[model samples]
Target: MKFAGIGVLNAARKTIARMLGNNEIAYESAKSQFWVVDAKGLITEGRENIDPDALPFARNLKEMDRQGLREGARLVEVLSVKVVIFLLNFDF
Candidate 1:
């Protein structure tokens, strides 16, 4: 956080991820853990009913035949994407 500085919200998320598991890194940030392969979209959970609030950042990965979201695949965070890409996409 020294260089980019730390946001309380982001930090809190990081801590949450650390506590949860490294695989859970994305959930810590406001980003989606999107795409579980062949799921058609970026939803965190592939199946089972979910409230919109449960995975708010999980951009739906539905096929075009399904309701398509224009800003699909965009989230404030994703786990371990390259630093450059992360910086480019980062937003408060």
Candidate 2:
């Protein structure tokens, strides 16, 4: 999936990470996974600098070729990417 920038990605990533790490224990026995991306393109180990929060989920996941760059790329600007979950909810 795609995000806006370091700040945006960091905020959302840490939030989701907390949600995944906490909510799973809070609600169920299973675990959860999350992915984030932004203007510098896809988040990966190859990228020198990335949001600090994004570090946890930065499993060096594969990147698609067109995952290019833009001066001011927003989440909406992501031309294409793999699926990303934004709002995951549980009854509990």
Candidate 3:
């Protein structure tokens, strides 16, 4: 993914690395891990060290070609149900 400049990519990588290495945060687990995907939906960072059992979204992103990632990327979370329905039905 393309970004405003190399600074963005560097920053993203540093953030992910920090999160992964942070001792106070339970960011990495058997069921959880970090990933950096670009605007075009390609994995930019974290692919090289990804685990095989990562979430389906992470695994899918890893399959894309990061060589062509672009700018305007944003963090996203995938939900099992319609967002509105899920939010309304959720308790607490």
Candidate 4:
């Protein structure tokens, strides 16, 4: 399974980390994958000022555009993950 989250600081990334760490949802058993996108864009390498909790989920910049995206619709369209979790209050 693939999961994409829209917000990182507002408890979304932490919750997912806890779930994966505690094995609460069998994410490992199913080989689920997770990605997080904060206000700037997809969390990628060299993204300054990243919350410590969100560092583990960050991916290489080469895999995605590092310029950043502002809209949730664009994020969904580009990531193409099986599930998208919007943990923040988005205007969309």
The residue pairs that clash in candidate 1, if any, are 40-61, 41-61, 42-61
Q: Decide which is better by lDDT, 1 or 2.
A: 2
Greater-TM-score candidate between 3 and 4: 4
Residue 38, candidate 4: Cα error in Å is: 1.1
The TM-score obtained by model 3 is 0.22
What would the per-residue lDDT of candidate 4 be over residues 9-40, giving only the tens digit for each residue? Answer: 33444465576674645433222355566666
List CA RMSD, all candidates. Answer: 13.3, 10.6, 13.8, 8.5
| Residue 24, candidate 2: C-alpha displacement in angstroms | 12
Candidate 2 structure lDDT: 0.43
Give the whole-model CA lDDT for all candidates, comma-separated.
0.34, 0.43, 0.32, 0.49
Q: 1-92, model 3: which lDDT tens digit per residue?
A: 22233344344435665767744342333113333333333233344533232222243433333422232133343221112111111112
Rank by TM-score (best first): 4, 2, 1, 3
Candidate 4 local Cα displacement, residue 69, angstroms: 11
TM-score each candidate: 0.24, 0.35, 0.22, 0.44
Q: Give the per-residue Cα lDDT of candidate 1 at 56.
A: 39
Per-residue lDDT of candidate 1, residues 20-76 (tens digit): 665645464424322221112233444354333334333444531253333223332
Against the hidden true structure, what lDDT does model 4 obtain? 0.49
Candidate 3 shows a clash count of 5
Q: Model 2: runs farther than 4 Å from truth?
A: 1-32, 61-82, 85-92
On the 0 to 100 scale, the lDDT of residue 9 in model 3 is 34
**Top-TM-score structure, candidate number:** 4
lDDT of 4 at 72: 26
